[model samples]
Target chain A: MPSAPAGTLYRGREGMWSWVAHRVTGVLIFFFLLVHVLDTALVRVSPEAYNAVIGTYQTPIMGLGEIGLVAAIVFHAFNGVRIILVDFWAKGPKYQRTMLWVVVGLFVVTMAGFLPRQLMHVFGGN
Target chain B: MAATVPDLAAPRDPYARRKTTRSNYELYGWIFMRASGALLIVLIFAHLWVNLVSGEGVNAIDFGFVGGKWANPVWQVWDLVMLWLAMIHGTNGVRTIINDYAERDRTRLVLKLFLYLAFTVVVVLGTLVIFTFDPCPTDAAADLLPSFCSSLPG
Candidate 1:
């Protein structure tokens, strides 16, 4: 039997990191969707309850949180499509890393397009 | 004294790990994931655009706003589809994670039990809310009703 090293840093490649990020974002989006469902369900309880619940989300802090939620969604969706391509396409695995970089580039561009308008909604003087 | 005997009833194939004979379920799930992801992009972005990007943005999301949107069958269906697809997709993703990480059968069972329960609750409640929502209930206590409810001609 071979003895294992005391401390082994398993440095994973881009594919591994993308897998990790996919799982993380997936879980984050899961919980967020749960809360969103419950809050949206407030409409059934009473208008007061619904309005009050939604009103809490209008704060600047929640605005930032919404940005994070959107980021999670964009990453998960983009990576999810990449995963599908990898699973089904003939040349997918060979260019998986390139696909990951493409996902990241799209994520950055989408967020840049989204952030200014979102920040203005949050911080622009009304 | 009874002799201790080694158990020999188990299957001899050490590599045999209860493989699924049904391949179509997974194939369908994979297809569903991509199909739903594509649709969700449109549904979610349109939802955000209507609710937060247009008009007064997030602040416009109130009882009246939601009521007005739900008053239309189109928005109601859009929201219903979004709720179902997102919940199902997320639940399946987590189920995959649980299967990968949970070493013990009992642990996997318990975790998925709870996951399914939560999924059921969200889907059922969300669907019911979308379909059955009454923005202006005549029977509601006047104090609990939205201010606009009083103005509508009965």
Candidate 2:
């Protein structure tokens, strides 16, 4: 019979999504980081070699992909800062709701300010 | 005559004082986890789709591919944004787990100290790589290079 587990992994008001996000994103970033470091080593191989690898980035679709990347980065960074404050500082969690709203606000504002420049560049705007 | 505001400053509960000595930090921490996690799902999956699915899949990846992506401001900004968000989210999640698990205050401080150090190293290095990546070196065996090199102005 399918029913809610007696011991819910996420028992609090905070849903499983963020907990899962935090973990998943962490693992993804770590894996990506390894690939990134190795890739950078290509520069030491030769500039042309490096350029060849990088040349694949030039596409409008890829530009769209970049938009998603920024969203991930922004949310993760903001949330990470929040967690750091809560852990190191005793009173950090007191303002959790306020902080959550603030993070969202910041994410939106930052993306709005930044994404357009990306669009213009990808479209070959001056 | 009806009372205008009925002691507007009066406490809601006669038993509870208006100025309690309680701090609401845990409340915020809990909320942050849920909110950030929700946002991470979209960001993470989209990243996967672009890198692993769209176009030539992972095999299409190379110096040229990356160079091509970053050549446009869109991917550059995209990468930059992803770096900042994920780094902060992961760091914060770890910090929370550490606080709950760590007992000694000094121990907590040391753990976080190292965490901050690692975070700094990653963010700085990542930013440098994204902005400063130069795929085309001045002197190299042109034959070994990608086809695009032949087109660059000598």
Candidate 3:
């Protein structure tokens, strides 16, 4: 039992969610990798055919899709780095708490860097 | 009866038994896994539905389909975000796995160096493709150009 008591944040649950995300992202990224590789192979299949296939990616709806994908990737990468630290360094536990904020800081910086253009597209600004 | 074995007390250094100095890295890492993961859940599902399940379904995807998506700046940014996120996520996740398995200090360093290198290559190339993709390329020359290109007034 946690000494922190109920009604407050559940510490264990937080860790559980992280583990689950790590696994789930693994599977999803693998699936996407397959499709991406196959699509790239189309380049050898003649220019017309390849161009046609790539063209659909330009659609607005799909544009949003891309945003969602990149976001998943960035988050997974940053958090993954954090996990690596914990496993190797014996001192990992000492900084585990503060590292959460670092990851968030990175996440925010990443999103801020890209959001302007992303929102511009949705709003039809550029 | 179990075989009896000799028990010995190992000498311990004072420093070895002392609580390690703090760094809070684990706390952050643990938090990141859950938070990013929660977000990935929505992003990942939305991705699948649009690409594989929406109107015309998977068959609807093709070169022209992709070109169309990127023509809109929306997708350019979307892809940019997804690429950044997944790459970071996968890289970080792998880093975790690496630390867990690789014991030697030198080995860990070498492996991470490679991982980051691969991450950089993929991210840079993917971003370039997203931003530079051309839908209506006529550079193949008029003879080899798509019929649609020929019909458009120059």
Candidate with best lDDT: 1
Two-way DockQ contest, 1 vs 3, winner:
1
Could you give the CAPRI-style class of model 3? incorrect
True contacts kept of 1: 0.73
**Interface RMSD for all numbered candidates:** 2.8, 9.6, 10.4
Q: Residue B95 lDDT in model 2? A: 82
Q: Is the docking of candidate 2 incorrect, acceptable, medium or high quality?
A: incorrect
Candidate 2 per-residue lDDT over residues B57-94, each given as its tens digit: 44456655666667779877877876776677667767
DockQ of each: 0.54, 0.10, 0.08
Model 3 chain A weakest 10-residue run by lDDT:
A117-126
* Local distance difference test scores for all models: 0.86, 0.65, 0.63
List, residue by residue over B3-112, the lDDT tens digit for candidate 1.
Answer: 67775666765775688776688778878888898898889878878876777678778777887788789998999999999999999989999998787799999999
Best by TM-score: 1
TM-score of each: 0.83, 0.52, 0.50
Model 2, A1-126: lDDT tens per residue? 543447645655543455556566565555455456545556556666565655545467766765666666667667666666666667877876566678779889978865766666456432
TM-score of chain B of 1: 0.78
Ranking by DockQ: 1, 2, 3
